[model samples]
Target: MAAAERRASPRRVRTALVALLAAFAVLLTGVSAEAQQRPRTVLEMLFGGGQQAAPERPAVRKPVVRKKKVRATRPARQKKQRTQAARPKPSGQQSAAAAVAAPASKNENAKTVLVAGDFLAASLADGLSNLYADNEMIVIEARTDGSSGLVREDHYDWTEKLGPILDEAKPAVLVMMLGSNDRQPMTVGSRSLASRSEEWVRNYEERIGEITEATKSRGVPLVWVGMPPFKFDRMSEDMVFLNDLYRKGASSVSGEYVDIWDGFVDADGAFVYSGPGVNGQTTQLRNSDGITMTNAGEDKLAFFAERAINRLLGTTLAATGALILGPDQLPTIQLPPIGNAANALQAAPVSIDDPSLDGPDMLLGTGSAGGFSLEPSPRERLVINGGGTGGTEGRADNFAWSEKSAAVTPSGPPIVSRGSLNLQSVRESGGLKPPEEMPTILDAIIEDWSRENEAARPE
Candidate 1:
């Protein structure tokens, strides 16, 4: 009975301890809630003994003033996503950037002049390099490939070659000359076109456009040097046609077309083998074959383009009045040709009509003693062969011919000699006979020829 009493007493003590702990915990929780709900003043915190003050009225918690909930809009999310995407470049674009990375120019202080084309262009470059040898600002880069032309892609492909050159050199100006060798047939894919054919010309022009585009893409100015005349007339004609194409192509790109043909030709427009050199001294300018120029000729060729290049480069002479040409372009002016001491230029008089002023007969007609004639020469008459009895095989037709009155016909019309007949009186008056009463011109030619033959016999 004592043991049972002991167990009940211990159980009662444990219950009382648990009840006390529960009351203390409830008090601590209430204090914590009150402290958090209301801020304390310094005096209250010091004197209030950490006890929560009772409110005058039952306190109602102010509505929690939380920031207004912001709902994310679809457009804003989309915009955020786009900004993030733009911050990072796509993988494909990164690969492209790697592939197309360009090479920088090696020399910036020196203005690079890219001279490229066939043999002629090489010669031009040589001359220009020599010309600018002392020039500190210019650097001539010669990239000529002889035997290369627009037609023969197998030899060299300029379109493919130019990009790398442009990237590496970054030339300020591009000078070229190529058509001298491109006058042959061109084969495009499976088809073939004859030289200078309509189709060939189109293809050639397109190739030129490609070159111009490649140059202009890099912001380089182009100068296309035209081909000089060839020794053969037919080849010269072809060169003229080619020059037309070059001019058109150059003009399309706002490029300069240098016409060096006149510099290489004579006053009569014939290909000259000898001409004034860089020093104005007469020198052999062309090779024996007449196709290529000599050193002197090449320098002369550059003279034609020097002024233009100087303008483009903004080059000017120093305070001294001098030429931009090699050292000085002004040649020593020589006195006029004088045949004899009496005919010296200093002694010669400037008369209104000086007989000494020699020129072609077209400029100086024969003296008034001989009657001048404006009649059509026998050579100008067209010889038309027909059944005629004028002792001639063909009938000449400068005037009308009639077979009805062949026997009694006079020469078609009187051959009016100029300066001797009044044309107005002749046209108005009945000076011109009818075609029926006029003989064919064939008889007149026959008589003239026979008379000339007689005059020449034993004379």
Candidate 2:
């Protein structure tokens, strides 16, 4: 029975192989029909024949559709360029000029001074104008905003406004002073900071730097006038800090910083409302508000700034106008003639015979016992007088001196005249000496005392 089953399995396998061959022939016929309807590549056929065949008509390149380039006309381009160039560049100075009106006619040779800043700057302008009023070569152009500061950007911005004025005025020198109205909170975009805060100081300095850079870019010198002391102590203190920022900012850009703080302060650094005027009399420099300056105060402020301006301009124009008349053009001095003035000498030798130097003709002591003589005596003698009552009051002492004789010795007693008084007590006391020696009065007195003592000794 097992052998019969194996023979039956072989016949079954042959029947299964014939059925599989029939199915494969049916799939080939279906693919050939689809290929004949539409073209297909080897890659498309391998990829399940989803993609269409590439169109082949000698591989046409679509005629290379090159666009004809339209070049601009040289004349038109030049005209457009000229129009653009003709329009003034909106520079800092130009914008500043547009914001602030300036004079139309100005001297080309004159030195233009742009006095710029806040309220303080207005006074500075006035002072500078008056200072250079006599000088035809200096033209003061004032560009000031009273209600402006670096803090208030909404009202006025110095960094944005200065460029235009600088452009139109073309100042040879810039005199600037601000920060008076800046002692408050500053708002930059959404951020707000109090004055003197770290952020605000940094921002303030940046604005000053921008202004400084703009001025220096034109190769023009700048003079930054420092804020003066205010009437209030706190206000003055804030000004000090602001002035420091100005000094550093101006100095960093090779500009001059004119310190005017001390000019408005006392020795103790306190703010003074009424101080010494420029003429040395006490005058009000600041108003009752203690912020703005008076006319005299403005003059003083300009006095500080003028020093820096004069240095830049050299003041040569002022010197050129000074009139220096020669001696020929001056009036001659007329002096009156003095009596014997031409013969008079500043110094002269002493003259013994001059009548002006002669002694009086009348002699002294003439009415007395003896007359006084101007002439010197021929004989020389030392006169002494004892208290004798007979002599005249005008008589001098009668002590006579004699020249030495060959027979007389220098050590011998002096010879006495018969009329001379003899001190008898001296002779009795063994104090008497031979003629030719002079006796002192003390010796005579001692001898007289000795004689008295000897006599009184119980004899």
Candidate 3:
């Protein structure tokens, strides 16, 4: 019995030791997991590759250098992105923040002008607006779409809306481009600006006068964009007429006519979208349908335009890839054309007070003789007037009539709109398919082309 009790005591001691070891092991595991949840530097993350242990400091440096370039190549937009990366990038969007912090500008920088049209304007507006890189000199906002006839109430009264901003900004430079959507006709004088382009010519002259006067009032320098060519499929001939008007009219203003088309225009005013290829084969600069640009296209445009503006502002930026020193953008590796310097600008386009009740391209809808018409309405000539969208989902119809909308035509009235077609019974009826994101090739082509092409010309 004594032997047995003695053995039992020792056994109890061993069991306790085992239990304590188990508890200690569990505690150690808990501690290990807690450490993992804490923040780590790039150094701490280096041990992930089946690494049983962390390497010393000197060992990490070389690997990071090699990996960085490789990882950066994952994106193709590195040209512009590199500049951004060089800046102390804050957590979210740096573009919006940069514009907000940019101080007000003064001097020729304000007057030194560059202008772009629609899609290009949108790109520039978001991409290169008020960068604060150029000291108190450069200011540009190009966001007018030509497809919408730029009348007083055109596209949210852009001229009116921009009036206060322009006045307050007191720009010395003004660049203008528009007239793509002037396909339809309206009356400016007692005459119609319709299929009879001669009438349109007079109206165009009068309208341009209004714009030039506005710029003069503000003492802004002016650069005017002439129309570029569209693809042969959609607007080959019509574009020529309009482009010609742009050339003649732009010349009339005594404004610097930067014929965006001429530099890129072919003998037939055709636009090729690319630089020369390796072989003698000619590569196109624009995309397949001829309006939107590829990457190289934008690169050339940005390079030239930025250089022009940079020179106008008299910043010490080299159009060649020269890195900037203190308070300057890096050197641009671009070659821009040096033309005769622009003349001093005068005033802004002033509103003319004619008793005429005409918009740039307002239509009186005659009932449908509809064969391939751009007419958006049947009963009343669709007034393709521009205004606020006012939270309407399918509000475009209120602006212009689109026969292309997926809305079902009512057999009853000839006066239907795009928004109405989208919002109506055929849409809401049972078993009807919901709207799809499908855009036809033509539609896609036009939309894409217009955006890129428009970027070169804004209202």
Between candidates 1 and 3, the one scoring higher on TM-score is 1
C-alpha RMSD (angstroms) for model 2? 34.8
**In model 2, which regions exceed 4 Å deviation?**
1-108, 316-459
Q: Which is better, 1 or 2, measured by TM-score?
A: 2
TM-score, prediction 2: 0.47
Residue lDDT tens for model 3, 230-292 = 666355466566666655655565555554555455666566666543233455556776766
Q: Assess every candidate by TM-score.
A: 0.46, 0.47, 0.40
Q: Output the better candidate (2/3) by lDDT.
A: 2
Clashes of 2: 21
Q: Which stretches of candidate 1 lie over 4 Å from their true place?
A: 1-108, 318-459
Give the alpha carbon lDDT tens digit for every residue of 1-459 in model 1.
999999899899999999999999999898888876878778878777454656688789889888998986323111001122234566666543324322222234767778889988887887776666545567778898889988899889987897788888888788878877887899999999999888998999999899889988888888888998878888889999989988998888898899988888889999888987878898988887888877777777777767656666556641121335553544654434433332122563578786657655554555433333344333333344333223222435323344434565657565557477777687799787667775579988998899999999994
Ranking by lDDT: 2, 1, 3
Candidate 3 off by > 4 Å: 1-117, 123-139, 145-147, 151-162, 187-192, 248-253, 262-269, 276-284, 303-459
Give each model's whole-structure lDDT. 0.74, 0.75, 0.52
Instruction: List the candidates ranked by TM-score, beginning with the highest.
Output: 2, 1, 3
